[model samples]
Target chain A: MGDIDIANDTVSADVVAKFDLPAYLHSQQAIVASHLESALEPRYPERLFESMWYSLSSDGKRLRPILCLAGCSLSGGDPELAIPTACALEMLHVASLIHDDLPAMDDDDYRRGKPANHKVFGEGIALLAGDALLAYALEFILLNTRQVPAERLLRVMHTLINRVGISGLVGGQAVDIECEGREDIDLETVEFIHTRKTGSLIDAAMVTGATLAGADDDTIARLSRYARKVGVAFQIVDDVLDVIGTRQELGKTPNKDEKSRKATYPRLFGVDGSMQRARELVDSAKKEIAPFGQPAVPLLAMAEFVCTRTS
Target chain B: MGDIDIANDTVSADVVAKFDLPAYLHSQQAIVASHLESALEPRYPERLFESMWYSLSSDGKRLRPILCLAGCSLSGGDPELAIPTACALEMLHVASLIHDDLPAMDDDDYRRGKPANHKVFGEGIALLAGDALLAYALEFILLNTRQVPAERLLRVMHTLINRVGISGLVGGQAVDIECEGREDIDLETVEFIHTRKTGSLIDAAMVTGATLAGADDDTIARLSRYARKVGVAFQIVDDVLDVIGTRQELGKTPNKDEKSRKATYPRLFGVDGSMQRARELVDSAKKEIAPFGQPAVPLLAMAEFVCTRTS
Candidate 1:
């Protein structure tokens, strides 16, 4: 709290003292969870919806959606205006997770401490549910976003799709798949995979939120840089957690990355070195938005939270 | 050609005589193919793009994109304005095909006289390629569309996504999978499945084209009705061909649906009866758009093409 006040001169010490990051994250998470719950009501073809909801409702941190809302607020826009886009971000995240856990992909049996989507619904329905969720995320944003210009909405859509398409998340996953079980994987290759696989969507989440809130290009760019740092840091922490934490603590199988021989930050740098790198990234991420002062409090805290979080 | 002149009082006999359906289809298909060829350039992660392009460039009728362009032309908009969207429709169609051929779904080994996507590229890359194409379709539309108002583009996106999401293509597919091998499946369930699985995307193609061209509500609705009829008829013809055609002509294994004990139009109705039903649908589809006069000539010819097509 003292560091935040010292970093942003425009943020008063009193406000810093009163701000609670956990409470803010919890409240924002609740809002996103509620919106997601009401977004899809069970209809005909109950099985598909059931499978979709099963993965969507899993107990996990709603990190991407929370970042989106925080991005909106940091840009001096009403957080309420970003709810639909927030939910859409989570939907895309869950869709990717469901597909990633398939037998043909990562073959993970557990996710967030629950059976993988295919394990419960079988592979066919799980695949269709993922496809449905991807399309529905776009539909939900187009139909539900309000009080924003059409141009802004289109920009948000463009950013979201671009980050998720071939040049971003999908591209990263493809390269990662190709590199599996290879002994020649380097730090640069690992960074490339993590940057696009995890970092690109995080960039989209923040950039889209700020875009929706009418943030100028400079502000959006700054937030993007901030997000990139935090994104990589977040993944590094995940790697460290995977090596050092248990299934009960991480809500996933521990040491699975080692078993698969997948390249990870901890694998190359060891847990202590990787954690030190994550701290440096979080520090740089906070500095990127220091000029925004009071408006960026939540985002600054979120950057810190990335390296500190256990799961 | 004679029936076309008789069906529309506003179309002159001279115009009907000059309108060659095959030549027109060939020209439009060439244009769509050219556009699609240029849309995706080879980039990094060469294997992924190779897999995506392999399926996208397969030999098939460019029916959906042609319908979209025709829809735009019918609404008096420059067909060029709808070219990006036309390409996007084809991308979505190809993406669905790739997924539908997966081992967990249809388990198809051949498509369009060649190996299925998963057969050529492993199932994981095939799945990711499908995901990339789906997302790229949205990104392509947002990036390439010009000379259209942002509001109309949003509406078009909404319609495309809605039809492709639950209660449309995905919902239809879910039910189809569930009803497979069940003898008690009735005509109503089959219609319900076909309407969503096949009909919805076709409806989206035409309706989105009209919407982008500034068609009135009534005209868009009329075109949707026309699309729904042709879509069902198109599936019926596919069913008939599955029963009566060979692998050489169909470009896939014949009678696979029957082998799987899946319900189909020809399964419920004899091949002749299904063909007869398709003819009736084509006739009614033409009636729905006849009021558009000479502007609907391409679509009118397309309606006839749907039933008469041998592949």
Candidate 2:
């Protein structure tokens, strides 16, 4: 049976559990990762290609791209048609990570299980590689995606640009970098950084997928609200994990946020309070998707999974 | 008369001289510059906004964007309609300059008679500022542009991404950085670097204008040829300037390329030979546009202008 049919079935708990969200997410991740593998067949300067793919081939949670694909599937749109868009989201994420890990930015030496791109390729190549990925992400969608109408593609294009560009991703990153080592950062500053840097892409991914699936304005607005909650919750949990989580569990640096004096939710709110906020966000996010009913079952499960991943 | 009508005038050398190209270029530059001034209006963080505009408001020639507007006007399209696309080209160019001037890249201290972005801001803030400009360029076009058809806008978007992304700007930057201080680099390597790094944006600027004006494939191909020749000539002129040019003229460091052991045309061919070669490229570039007859006058003058510019 199709995944949707399995999603629709309210049979025994055993069948219901068989069609669990984790399995769905796993298959989606593999599909997106596999597509991402060939997404960058760069021309000259083999090192540029190497630096770009190094971080991309790592073992991070395919959260944003899967959310895009989930958004598409939930709208009864062809998920296959959304895969290139999915790949684009993942590529943009990698681009941001490559830049963020530079000695000038986050200054981390390790990402995933390997040395950071800058550590392996040097800082200059890493910076250029990040730029390449960012530019190629948009081009890949334009050249590779098929069976989607031009209007939908245009909407998707605008959505990605706003999310990753100045209005969203870059703006937040600037504020985060500026706020580093400052002890007097307020709640407003923390919220601004998290929403722009972390929340923008998540919101864009869901909205882009919904747009590609021919979603209306109301549906898109609801997904935007839902995505903001999920994104803020994700960042709060991330702050908590960085403070107390281990390398084996997080797969990268830990407690670095605290060391950097970054304005984080966990710092502003205590760990217990942060966890409470995440759960509350998850509940509200699920409520936003309530009108979608059964199709949103997986989406609701996603929020729950996000709220208490390792607790 | 419309700009194209004046372009078609060929009564006398005096009239041709009277209807000069500089006046047209000046007006176009003013419009593009004015639009670019308010192109970025960041909401929350003021520092980010300041860092972004610092490089943008400098006293550069504004060549690429003016070329875009000129191309649109030459095609009988509304120059006013091309302003947003023109602004985007300038923004992307500024983004490249910001990143390229970083300590890890060219490591230049000066740009446009002032300190480079990284020299003015810290390394981290400079990097983020560049990212902000790059992202904002795309967003600005998607958000602010009007009256252009969706297909044309899509075409313009694709062109910018390809020109600025891996296959173009970022790829060449990686190679240029890698080849620096290496004696084994050959003429082919120089061609690859200059064409991708410098020529890509020039080509994109011309193609974008013509595409916005709905020019035919034949016309676009001719403009592409024109752009390549002019781009190479510009790079050759740049190489000569670096060796024997001044801070007052170039507005940045001189002789740094030689210090880095860069593969420059003037280094391979003597300075006089490189100048001769530049004139030849300019001559051939003007010839490609000769088929357009009277409407190609400004373009021909532009080639002549490129061949001999002291300051």
Give the fraction of reference interface contacts each candidate recovers: 0.89, 0.83
Model 1 TM:
0.95
Clashes of each: 0, 0
In model 1, the runs with Cα more than 4 Å from the true position are: A1-18, B1-18
TM-score of predicted structure 2: 0.94
Candidate 2 positional error at B232, Å:
0.8
Predicted structure with the largest lDDT when compared to the true one: 1
Worst 10 residues of 1 chain B by lDDT: B1-10
Q: Give the C-alpha interface root-mean-square deviation per candidate.
A: 0.8, 1.1
| Model 1 C-alpha lDDT per residue in residues B167-213, reported as the tens digit of each score | 78888888888887798889999898888978988999999999889
- Poorest stretch of ten by lDDT in candidate 2 chain B: B1-10
- Identify the candidate with maximal TM-score: 1
- List, residue by residue over B1-311, the lDDT tens digit for candidate 2: 12232234433334334557788778777888789878877565677778889998988788889878777766767877778888989989999999999999999999988999988888888887888788788878887778888888889999999999878889888899999888888888888888888888888888888888887777778888999899989988888889998887889999889999988898888799999999999878877776566667777777778877875
**Candidate 2 Cα misplacement greater than 4 A, ranges:** A1-19, B1-19
